[model samples]
Target: MTEIELNGSSAGLSGLTAVPWKNGSLNEALACYFCPQKTLQADRPKLGKVFTARNLSRIAGIEIRWTTNLADHLRLVDDDQVVFIFHCASFLQLQKSLDKSPFPDSFLQETLDTLALLFPSSDNETTNWLKSLTKIDPRLARCGSLRTRERRLENFNYWHDQLVILKQAFDESSPRNISQWWFDRRNGVQWYTFWIAILVFVVTIFFGIVQSIEGALQVYLSYKSIQSG
Candidate 1:
């Protein structure tokens, strides 16, 4: 087994405490590689009979802590562990990076080559693990940094408050309430007809008023002509 740390803090390793993962170092490395944080735990559901050695199952019981920072990173302290210290950033940005450099591409392939050199293994099993890890780089990017998650949460709350106010306004019984009601296809036709009827009524009333004013003006003109005669 190999110990791989990517852009991980080497300085923090000095003050670390130890944890048990079987009696073997190889097992310990496997445990760290598939640590139980959300990203690591996410890998487990996909693993099958083809991906790992029979002995790998023994280390599966180990618990890997997930962290967004140093405290979470320091929690795993087994020898020969492969630790990937991911820098949390916007999921959107991470996704963009992934899209620009997809898995097994030239840049990613070169990156994996360096990782393979760090971990040195000839077993085809190692390829499976690298493939899985490769899948993870992009996924972690998609999961995003903690800040983006918080902003999404804040946005949800703001929209929720606005919706609540809209609902309250909608529920109150008044002529205005009719405008707030949601329209379905069946009701939309009726709503359109109602508006058309109202528009026609307004036009008719305006025409009637204009006709009445015209008649009154004519009568006044006739009376003025009689007075002049």
Candidate 2:
């Protein structure tokens, strides 16, 4: 606070003026870019299969909000000429930046809306001025579509890698590899049931033959007794 030497009898503040208030955010014009409106809270589902409908959104660098800053120059526009200058400059900057950045379509759309809200038309003359100058830039308009294609490619590659890993795991776990895995050098048991399994296999065959022979003998005896009677 700075106290000025004001003559007494003044009811207000006794001639003391507080310093200008400051905030944590950037300029109000750039507020939308720095701070987005609160999104509805929900559980973001993790990717499910190697391929899914939503993989693009998960894998691609999709920005639900503007996650990066604009060039410093756009912030330097004069207050009186803010609408006239920013309208053209922002679109051009966005187009150039899109070639290098992975900013999603939603980010661009919201940015435009924020700027519109910031500089609303006051009269018919200003409204017409805005239309002629803020005519949509072709390149900026295509950012959303380009981002969509890029996202799909990114998402597909993610699934392709997952599929490869899954295949390797499946092959390792397959029945043919089971006994080998169990008796691997890493196993502390250092014992294998390969021969024991073969012995049990032979014993099972012997039991089957014995059961077949006994069934035949009983059937033959029953036939002989019936014929004699």
Structural similarity to truth (TM-score) of each candidate: 0.24, 0.20
Look at candidate 2 and give me any clashing residue pairs: none
For residue 124, model 2's alpha carbon misses the true position, in angstroms, by 2.0
For model 2 the local lDDT of residue 18 reads: 19
The digit string of per-residue lDDT tens for model 2 on 1-229 reads: 1112223332233222212224433223233333333322213212222221111112221111211223221221222121111233255445446754333444445444323322333334334433554344322222222122222212232122322332233223322343433423222343245555767989999999999999999999999999999
Query: In model 2, which runs have C-alpha deviations exceeding 4 angstroms?
Result: 1-70, 73-85, 89-101, 121-123, 131-229
Clashing pairs in 1: none
Error of 1 at 193 (Å): 0.7
lDDT of 2 at 83: 12
Measured with C-alpha atoms, the lDDT of residue 76 in candidate 2 is 17
